[model samples]
Target: MDSAPARHTGQNGTGPAGGGALAPVHPAAARRSATAIHPPRGPRADQARFALRPRRVHRRGRALPLFTADALAAVVTATTLPAVAPPVLSVAPVLLAALHAQAGLYRPRLAPSALLELPVLAGRSAVLWCSVAAVTAAADPARAMGWSALLTAVCLQVVLACAGRGLVNELQRRAAVRRPASALVVGPGAGASAVAAALHGRPEFGLRPVGLADTAAPAEGAGGALPLLATHEDIRRAVIQNSVGHAVFTRPPEADERTASLVRLFHDHGCRLWLADPAGTAKVTGMRLPHPADQLWGYSVQPLLPRPTRPLERWAKRGIDTVLALIALVAAAPVMGACALAVRVWDGPGVIFRQERVGLYGRPFTLLKFRTLRADAHEAATRWTVAGDRGMSPVGSFLRKSSLDELPQLWNVVRGDMALVGPRPERPFFVAKFSTVHPGYEARHRMPVGITGLAQINGLRGDTSIEDRARFDNHYIDTWSLWQDLWILARTAASFFRFRLGGS
Candidate 1:
């Protein structure tokens, strides 16, 4: 059979080491060549040689599969037993299975030994059996025999499955001693060369680099004893002829379409395609694959807590806020009414103060508060109010110190403009300015602004450093939880009383 042709200019429009333009193979031609090379035969004569194929080589440790199969068998056996029945036995096996799975005991990479996992399975099963017996003693002593019988069945199943998997693993290990997969490393660039080197270094990975397909003339004795098969255009043909099962595209081909088409061609021929990261080949550690949604967003917006309960939970929270806000507003009506009367008597009648503040997602909203300042305070440039500011009306100072000034924001929360706990909203001007100074500042808007937050509990209030305040805001966003919010609320109450007693 004629050797398959390669397509595309090697790395930089250079020919193969032998100096001939590589030939391109049509998809049909490549498929025919693969078939022609491997004629079907009966069972392999030598197990060791057959085991050399990549598909047959199980690089992942042997123990993991054994442990998993045994654990599963134990759980199934326990569940099937009639004697062990109750909240104790039923929930225990399920919980242990979940925990074991989470601990990576079932993963192919962490192959644990059957013997090791068997003890763990037995221990969990015993715990479940004991719990079941205890429950039976309390509920009905007569059921104890049925429960014990079920636990015995579970133990037997676990032992049998563990032994079976161990035998299979031993067989596979013996097979691996035989056949190994032959590989052709197409080193078109630094990335490709690096991949080739890695495969060469890890021979147990079942990759045999027959030769490198360099477009440039092979350096003097480049292939060494390995054959320098073909160049760029002949890559596909060469890969097909040599029975390559993996093609790594380290660098882009001369034509984008050609590269894309080549990847598809490889895939059609059952070759695994691995593309090098375009961001440069610096090895990355602890790299987590992003979810499909994360990929779509181009960024992460996960909360520290398990995804916010559910829609019903959110609605419940909103309902609680609305009911509480309404009741508080009603209870404070008399005081607010009296305060209005006092303001009318003392400062000539604007009892309510309305100021524009940034709200959710930077939207502007009118913040309602008791008129603590003279109405004309904004006539000059807007400035942050400080402790004992002369602009504060006599009545306003008492309102501000007591936090009665912020009670009206219950309305904001009720109106859905704010949450009960989140980063405190910023003034639109500050939001704009700070966002420019801090690139990640806008991430705070991912949740609705809140009436109070971690910053408030930490004594981060008016005129505090914006950077320090932002740090608290980010901390709240990152570590938000209903429990954390409750803690902050408790602290806020303590601070409120302390502030009230201390006065201005």
Candidate 2:
């Protein structure tokens, strides 16, 4: 995106040591500064990390009471129609589960009410019992269930399901009051702090405020012993360390790039991000409120991330990766062997230069490239570009320009260290440097690093703005699909011989 507004700020937007804004210091100094803050640890910290698990009833847990009630209802319905009881009892619960899933009965919500969902239950039960009657008729025409039997089944299902779920809701409310999920409040102004305070005072909401992320540094004791995360790094470190599962942002995520960056960061770490209307006054245009209740205290919560799509697409990605890597490795073996020989003959040794590059999820792996320069370990690690170095080695120039230097990374793809198409992997030095300097740089790790990527295709390669490269990479991941991967692969292949060394 555009250049980051400004560099590091302490809590409440204050500069470190009264500088108004801390100047960009050396990376080593910045690392030391980041290391200085020691967040609270021990039993309380452990509790914060583990609290989200079994913290409240949601998703499958919410469905449990309904399932139990439906089972009881199934018995009653079947007994009424003794002739078809066996088949009805065998299929009713399983069919209801599928139908309820489609009707969003399994979807988790912060404050769910069984009583409010009575209409949905009744409607689904009607459809479900009718389906059972139709299936029984098809299976055995002589023993088809009657209209009276179907009506009884539907009525019993709704009443029994509602009764069981009402009991579950009451039990769940008590449990939530006892143990709540850890939450982080994010936004500018006192709105975030106010919502956090309200949660602290009320235990029934099932949210325990662990910290706050705001544009300005919190006033002394404003957070009430909770941590303040002013910078993205601080936010990331805090979220990971404290096991923060929920994020409550007072403003809409679309308010600015910073808020958008927060969405990517939380999504990468798998946190549930929520946009909160703390005062419940502001409303974004074209936003539809969820049915029933969607309030946390006075704040209205809007989830930032959409529910994940079909699992088959994700499974297809792995299948694509493995299959394509194997084919590419075999197909390119001869070319790689030739490049190795060329390097050995001309460069005198060290045909393959192995360096640790940051990959998916900030994990490091050894990336293999043909040695093109005679730099020492320190120079290799810290050097930014060698596009026009006067090294005077024709062999090195040929390998770099021809893109033969990257052939060995096909092995990385096969080993699952990389993908055939994704953001190019950067050395650990640059990963650290860019992650701090560029907003959303670390978010690139959300997808596997690759040798060819959208950034390279768009010409944001060597010596380009790190911020723009991060932008394109994140965009690619955000819109990633199997077809997109195939298209990138096709473009890379079609341009393989003619592809410039700029992307190198």
Candidate 3:
């Protein structure tokens, strides 16, 4: 009657409460409890954690408020612009702002959600503007707003919306700094340490280290008093006790079932579970966790490949490139003419240098540029020119430094062989060699070569490390968008002027 002291049955065994009679424990539960109680060795334990959680989610502060404020400002600016009736303009901006806010255009992180929201925002703005125009026309036949006014309103709304968001962002950044979300990383040994170091170093993301949870005894005592919580039949209790919102598994778990069970249990309890991808560890960059659902639910996560160019996008890009290339060719024609004269006067006859380079899809093409080397230079020589190379003629040095030598590549852009902005094409000899050297080298050829690229503007021109250049190229391929292309072009302009002035 003072009876059993409330014995509890765990996965591995039954624990007696105050020396009470032992209760029968299920065989599977007993085994699990035993295994959990006795932590595995380093490598095995790390493998177990990796098997369980393969992806990691890094949480940063929300950008919703900033987005909302920016949208509101955009609305206000559009509504107050001249030539538009205040009422009509006012309604459109609010609706547009709401659409953009709902679309999450202002999120601090650029996830798929933000990308998906862009078109939705643009479409909603279009519809709202069209509706306003239709209603206004119906109401006032004589005072109907012209197309210019409507267009002006649309442009002003977008500009102001972005500007407003930017201003609010600066203010928010100044007001109070919030710390990064705390992560509870669980793994074998050194792997866990790596995760902790990465998170600690990147405080901009606001991740604060609460503590580490591992199966094996950590080499460093669990930073004094932050218990190395035991793992028994179930990890759910341990996770909850620690109030861990995110669980990063740095190594695979011992059993697939255990991994699956952990994922389900943590997810059910409102915790985000992540597993480290094996392929990610090989790179210097830390492990990349795929989209959350992909990791937890076992979905395929592949790098996005180039699709057949969209008609509208293709035409738009082509038109812009052609028009600009032509204009540039014209404007620089005099300078080019002068350069040609200078080259002939300073060195010799051939005013252009045409080299065989690889183009889209590994196809070979001739890239034309103003001759920046002596005509008598040996054809067999393929060495990359560095600063003060003896091969460069006097005019060639000035042209190469100013990038005026690159003007003729506009012809390549005009032709189908190149794009205005893409990975810079390399010579065929180097291409074959690099392809074998770098595994992801072929990926760059997916897009047509360019006059200037993400690499070039970043000061990754001649003689820079091939590995670093490829990384930037890969990044461009991975994150390409129309806006990004435009940004690159703008940056290229600023860089051109700056370099020209500095005679770089």
Which of 1 and 2 is the better model by TM-score? Answer: 2
Candidate 2 residue 185 Cα shift, in angstroms, is 9.1
Candidate 2, pairs of clashing residues: 11-217, 12-216, 12-217, 13-216, 13-217
Q: Write the per-residue lDDT of candidate 2 for residues 1-504, one digit (tens) a residue.
A: 011222322111211111111121211111222332244477677764464232322222556665676677766666777657475677877888887777667555666677788888899889887887888788888878788777877887788788877787778778878878777788754566666776677677677776677534432222134566667767776667666677887654533345546776776676776666654533421233455546666567655443224569866877788898888879888888888888888888888889888776566799988887788888777775444457727877777666777888878888889888888887776666665455556567667788888877775655566666766887787778988888887777767656543332
Q: Which lDDT value does model 3 have at 216?
A: 46
Q: Tens digits of per-residue lDDT for model 1 on 1-504? A: 000112111112222121112222211122212232332345653552353232321233444555555556656665665565545444654555665555444433211245665665566556645655676667877666554475676577656666765675555444433444455544343333444454454443444554454444333332232344333335545555556765544332211222333544444555543333322321221112211111101112111111232467567666766776688779878877777776677767677777776654345677766676774545412455644668777777777767777777778888887777777765555555555454345446545677677777776776455555666776776565666766776677777777422221
Query: Highest lDDT among the candidates is held by which one?
Result: 2
Q: Report, for all candidates in order, the number of backbone clashes.
A: 28, 5, 22
**Runs of candidate 2 exceeding 4 Å displacement:** 1-60, 63-107, 111-175, 178-198, 202-204, 209-316, 497-504
- TM-scores, one per candidate: 0.44, 0.54, 0.42
lDDT of each: 0.50, 0.66, 0.54
lDDT of residue 440 for candidate 1: 40
- Quote the lDDT for 235 in model 1: 56
The runs of at least 3 residues in candidate 3 whose Cα sits more than 4 Å from the true structure, single-residue gaps closed, are 1-304, 308-311, 375-381, 499-504
Best-fitting candidate, measured by TM-score?
2
